[model samples]
Target: MNNRTGCEDPYLNYVISRRPFGWNFTDPPVFLPFDFEKVDPFYWVSLMETNWKVAFYAAAVYIFVIFGLQNYMKSRPPFELRKLLFIWNLSLGIFSVIGFVRYVPGFLFVLNQPNGFYKSICVKDGMDVPTGFWTLLFAFSKFWELGDTILIVLRKRRLVLIQYYHHVVTMIVVWIVGPLVEPIARWYTVLNFFVHSLMYPYFSLRAIGIRVPVFIANLITFLQLSQMIIGFTVNMTSLYHQQIGNDCVRYPISIQAFSLVYGSFIFLFGKLFYDSVIKSGRRRTEKKLL
Candidate 1:
């Protein structure tokens, strides 16, 4: 299929033809690193296809560094790099907002058309467009987000298992599935971008000593849990399509892996909400009554 024009699939052609207001569908914006008009987006696709295994290597190194830093910090004073953490979260938050803008219009445009729902789940065209460029960056950004853990460790904060596990699994899964260019990836990318746009900025505010309300934090966790639930639903839809002999372009193994990861997230986040919010509220209420 021609990734540039998406001429082979009529639906994809339709999607590419209509440029929504404020959306960059063809070329990378000036702010982005590469000039997509000069460089084929497939060049990066080829790199991802070939070097996907490198995510595993990077994850291994990340694990080593985080654990080693944790042990080293046990005997020393924690360095409070408040300014740096603020910058980091703000940067990622901005990037996520950009990604959300780049990805969502096309997704909504596709979903509103006839048979659009199925096509959104199965069609894989327009890889040389702006969506493709941002998708590549989205995958790579997983690695950059690992820095959040490093910041936590340096601050002598308690690093929970869910935190690092989520980072590592997310990095690995995005790397492995990105080159496949599955249609379902649109949902994953869009929802994640939307969540992070709120999440990272909230963290940035806290980093700078801003007193955000408790409810806002709860809302963030709620959005994250919703994202996970939707992710599991998308994977299940893929599996159902495959079972019915539809032409969904996802591997069975990848679908299974995604299901497991998302399912685990549902449980982990639910526990977190219960422990931090519900139980804590009950405790405060009981103390008030006493």
Candidate 2:
């Protein structure tokens, strides 16, 4: 790491140098039983590494349950679990917001260093800090998010290919790559938290019968597409660095896998945006003329 003072900011300097692996908050306001400062992130890392197979098991169960439930619900009235949906989306939105807050500062701090952009994408740091704690939670949350498919199935909503594929692939990838603690993993975590913060809250509003503006819905899809584009770009850049023998850009296989996924997302989300926004708008216009 470069020897510059961390912008005269004590917190930033502490985050950069100390890289402490525990919560920064104290008990007076946010009271918890254990010592927040004493928590070890590596313990969680080891735990995740050992239990990575659980993601596959969960995915298998998830596939079986979603299809089975869809079949079972075919002859029944759709359940309107509006309250539960509201709660689920709201909880995830709040979690994502907190994650985004925790992650962005460290990410920005690293990005401002010398060759910061490259280092941010290449150097694996911050895995032993509070950020890592959130990253682990984010990975684990994928299993919880599989419940989304259940909601769709129960509601008799059409679960598109991208929906389940995205969930299962993401669950597997995050579980496998999360333990590696690659620098690029921060990029994935931060971008995902940022997107989900907006996404789940939007779902919350709709779940409770709020009529959100059409443009806002379109904007969310656009943002999702943009996120995929950025992710693809990041992976490709990392691959380029690795090709040129940049020692910091570790984990070539992981990068390639991520690149493939994001590349596919660009197509899937783009088609969704065009079909829902552009094509729908044209149809509405033609109807008005008719």
Candidate 3:
């Protein structure tokens, strides 16, 4: 009955402990804000914690909508499957590489002085530690990701359970952690930018018409797998070092949920990719030889 079995459910623990500071959730003439100082960080993350129900409907709704539209449109030019598919895969591929690449400079920024982010980028600073415009831009990117699912639906593409779940959940989780974990967010962002850079380009290419070199897709998957692996490794290492009374970066929650969510996603998708790519390729070669 417990969401946690140990004291080490990082995200659960950190999010539960978060208290609010003064910040606006949305701005403009109707600047809706929260008294960050008055609210508990726990409440904020809990409230925004990826709404799976909404996300589920969000994931499925589009598929059906497209199905109906396709049906009604009669001979609707067959959905232009080629170009759209290229863009989709191209985006995912480029995003992966770009995200990783972006992490490089930020890596140096911390290397010169260093905090735990050097090891893992999921660490957070207190609420006011704004690194400025670019940081906020990264924070807001979470919103843009909602459009990703839309792209899937519009193109009438198959939605893998893991892909659908991963995209939606990650978008929400990252947003939740973005503000909460600021210390090494730059590392995570740059890594993500690198990933996105590669990811988007891959998707674009897939959309336009090109079978992505299998290696590129494999590389993206490998990179993602590494991210999660590193995430888990760093969390436990930090946890261990902290236990030993050493001064480790104290952002456990980011890693906790990260390990849980991303770990599962990486494993699931990795297996999926391996099965579809490697195994299938092997089988095809074997069949040809026979």
Candidate 3, residues 1-290: lDDT per residue as tens digits?
11221234343333323323322121111111223322344343444455424434654664465456545555543356665556555655554454344335434544454453434433332222122223444545555565565555555566566655666566655665655544445555655666567667766776666688888887777776666666556556666767787654555677676668766876886787688777977998999999
Q: Which of candidates 1 and 3 reaches a greater lDDT?
A: 1
Query: What are the clash counts of all predictions, listed in order?
Result: 0, 0, 66
Q: Considering only N, C-alpha and C atoms within 3 Å, which residue pairs clash in candidate 2?
A: none
lDDT of candidate 3 vs native? 0.52
Every candidate's lDDT: 0.80, 0.78, 0.52
Cα error, candidate 1, residue 121 (Å): 1.4
Which residues of candidate 2, in runs, are more than 4 Å off?
1-38, 125-128, 288-290
lDDT of 1 by residue, 1-290 (tens): 22225456453355445532112242322132334422344567678889999999999999999999999999999999999999999999999998888777667766775777787777653233556667778889999999999999999999998899999999998888777777788889999999999999999999999999998998898898899999999899888988999887788768978998899999998888888778887998999999
- Per lDDT, the best of the predicted structures is 1
Tens-digit lDDT string for candidate 2 (1-290): 33323435444345434443322222121211123432455577788889989989999999999999999998999999999999999999999998888778777867876888897788754333456567778888998899888999999999898889889989988888777767788888899999999999999999999999999898899889999999989888888888888866457668867977898889999999899989998999999999
Per-model TM against the reference: 0.86, 0.86, 0.62
